[model samples]
Target: MKFNRSFAVLLVPLCLAFGLFALAQDSDDRARPAIMGSTIFDWTLLPVKVSEKGESRRVLRAPTATLDELECHVTTLNPGQEAHPPHQHPDEELIIVKEGTVESLVNGELKIVGPGSVIFQAANQMHSIRNAGDTPATYHVIKWNSPGMLSLKKAAKKMQK
Candidate 1:
């Protein structure tokens, strides 16, 4: 094959640019933890373990490179079962009901909600959720820490102790 010097010069820069682009993409993926990246979790495939008050499955928990923390899980409570006594924390939490009903007590206000309902509990406000149906109640709980809030992993570990 006959080669041209000008063509070779152009090819060199193209190859270098491609190499640098690929390296940048790989570094971007590595900079963020896998759990902190976008993920799709199938709740049916995850094993359910008994929580302090009911059955639950941890969906995800990871610290992001941006100094934020996320913790999520799905919990199932039997009829009349309470996940925990009324408590308050500094992390904001969101609960999405997937099945049955839940009686939520947020900062002394009570409300009964059903499937597909979303509940937002603000930071440091007393809250509790219990099954308010005849069957088991299932819901997804997603909690995250604000810039000035306490670390979610540390708080969970401390509660376990």
Candidate 2:
């Protein structure tokens, strides 16, 4: 076969352009660690266990009204139960399903979620998660409450009750 110099020249710029375009489309992956190793964080490890009303020694309750940024607790839902009775939070929550299946329920509707799955519970909107699977469901829970978020949540909670 005979080679075409003109066709080859045209392809060089096209390949270079593709490479440049791909590099320009990067994502936001910045690291920001507040309390490196403290009980204030949900995703990270804590020094020791703390107790409070509506909380158990093993399971740490939510309502992390700490500050602008707060790490909740790692709630592992075993087979046949909701992480919490259908409830909502004022601040945004990031629920990262680490293992097992998570049946997420929002306002009575059911949503089946599994490992590596996440379901956000919007502030003031009702949401909950349960493990419908046979095994336990583990997840890294992040409940961020910024200043007035807690106050707003308390008011809303009162209204619901």
Candidate 3:
């Protein structure tokens, strides 16, 4: 095939622009939700990970089809152990008791709740959960926000600095 040198010169920049555009689109897609349909997550199958506070079986920690900061995990706090001191975050959260009892402190008020109980903590509200029973207390922590919580974390870090 016969090629024109001038045409090739113009095509090079066009191809580079197209590649850059595609890369930007890909980056945007990553920020958006990746799941599209109903999904079932089994807690028993998820691997357990230990944090400074306690042990957790993280179910999902990614953006969902409808939420930007959808996170769900099963946490077990040993008797006499609390999940860190009372703290607050910008993301709203719910703790659903599954096994044993828990002492839930919200905004300095303490309440003991048992299995099948749900404790709702609004955004930026101080709250903490501790095992009230003699055995380990297990609960599911589910949280979500309109936008991701990274901005809140970054802002908090800046304030500390």
Candidate 4:
């Protein structure tokens, strides 16, 4: 290979530009989260890390910037399993069932939420989702948080007696 100093100099900037372009691709995880049908704002798919093996998995997340700020997740819970832990966060949450039924506990209030069933949870309130039927439970989860007294992760640990 003939080493051309002029050619090498020209290629260096091109390679650097390509590298920067590749890095900018998918800069934010929520930029392309798979949402059901929310085109009024930014919606995309979020890759949730489900460590434990579950029967099913589903999520449609749209994050503005932070994890819970104007975020959304459409989760489907198989019968006899919980999608999320029994914890709380510093954000107000709204869960609405789009299909099937889901059993959830919000601030100690348990209910079998079905289609059109909406539940509003305040910041720092304990919550959990468990499939309470023989079929899959799917819901649209929207979380918007104002400044709360404490983080749900910390509050959950403190409430343990």
Candidate 5:
């Protein structure tokens, strides 16, 4: 079989592109397996990491069958201490107040709520939480990434680099 020079030139790049795409897909699949079955997280068993602001406990961070990523963590903020500076991200999060009082920055407004209250921080919106009471305020944060959200996040990070 005779191969034209121009045709071969095009075929080489196309093959390379396909190979790269396959590699990328394979890496994504191997990154983390989808979490399955029931699981339990005991509060007392979770190791607490103390910081200047307060304490934190990372519960779970893994991809689920339906979600690209599911992350949960507990935060205990000392009085007048903020979890972090008001910031925004591509993933939405739910904050469930475990105890004490928290002042949450939701869409530029500060809302104060006590234990058992839940706050939803929409994606790409500025949000944060701080201990509003004299004692430490504890809250559980659940964040998730929908399909393709992880790719978008990675692209955004690459742009920032």
Candidate 6:
């Protein structure tokens, strides 16, 4: 059987396009399944992971019915220890202080707050948290990515590379 040169050229590009589409679909399938209905993440049951800075309890990292991605975690920052340097991301986040005192960089200012205090970090804004007291500081962080946010993040990462 003989194949036409023009047909071969068209077939090669078509096959490549399908292969790329299949790869994209496979990547999406590998993402964590979305959360549905009521769910409970008991504090006592969650495992704490110790790190050089302190301890952390990861609650969840999955999409919800209304969000592209939802991630929650609790951090225990040891005295005089900072979680990380002030950095910014496209996703906004909320920090709820549970114990001790914490100094958070919010909107370029460092403010100190204790238990029950809430800190909001706006999208693309520089923010960070550190223990400001003699005792360890514990806080719960909740971050979410709205629809299309994940794609934007991927693009930004690609540009950096």
Among these predicted structures, which one has the highest TM-score? 5
Per-residue lDDT over 107-150 for candidate 6, one digit per residue giving the tens place of the 0 to 100 score: 78999999999999999899999999999999999999999899
Give the alpha carbon lDDT tens digit for every residue of 1-161 in model 1: 79999999999999999999999999976875654666788868888898656799998887655536789999999899999899988788999999999999976888999999999999879999999999899999999865545446577779999
Better of 2 and 4 by TM-score: 2
Q: Kindly give the stretch of ten consecutive residues in candidate 1 with the minimal lDDT sum.
A: 145-154
* Cα error of candidate 1 at position 28, Å: 20
Give the clashing pairs for model 5: none
Poorest 10 consecutive residues by lDDT, candidate 5: 29-38
Candidate 6 runs further than 4 Å off:
1-27, 30-32
Model 1 reaches what TM-score against the true structure?
0.68
- Backbone clashes in candidate 2 total 1
Model 3, 150: alpha-carbon shift in Å?
Answer: 4.3
lDDT of 2 by residue, 75-136 (tens): 66657767577786567788888888888876568988888887777777878777788887
lDDT of 5 by residue, 12-126 (tens): 9999999999999999778767675469999899999999999999999888888888999999999999999999999999999999999999978999999999999999999
Candidate 4: residue 77 Cα off by (Å): 0.9
**Could you tell me how far off, in angstroms, the CA of residue 90 lies in candidate 6 after the best superposition?**
0.4
**Model 3 weakest lDDT span, ten residues long:** 30-39
lDDT by residue for model 3 (1-161), tens: 88999999999999999999999999988876675356789766899988655688988877656666678889998888898789987888899999989999877799999999999999888899899889888999998866556667778899999
Query: How many clashes in each structure?
Result: 0, 1, 0, 7, 0, 0
Give the Å shift of residue 13 in candidate 4.
37
Off by over 4 Å in 1: 1-35, 51-53, 65-67, 151-161
Q: What lDDT does the true structure give each of the candidates?
A: 0.86, 0.65, 0.85, 0.67, 0.93, 0.93
**Each model's RMSD to truth, in Å?**
10.1, 16.0, 5.4, 11.4, 3.0, 4.0
Clashing pairs in 2: 42-71
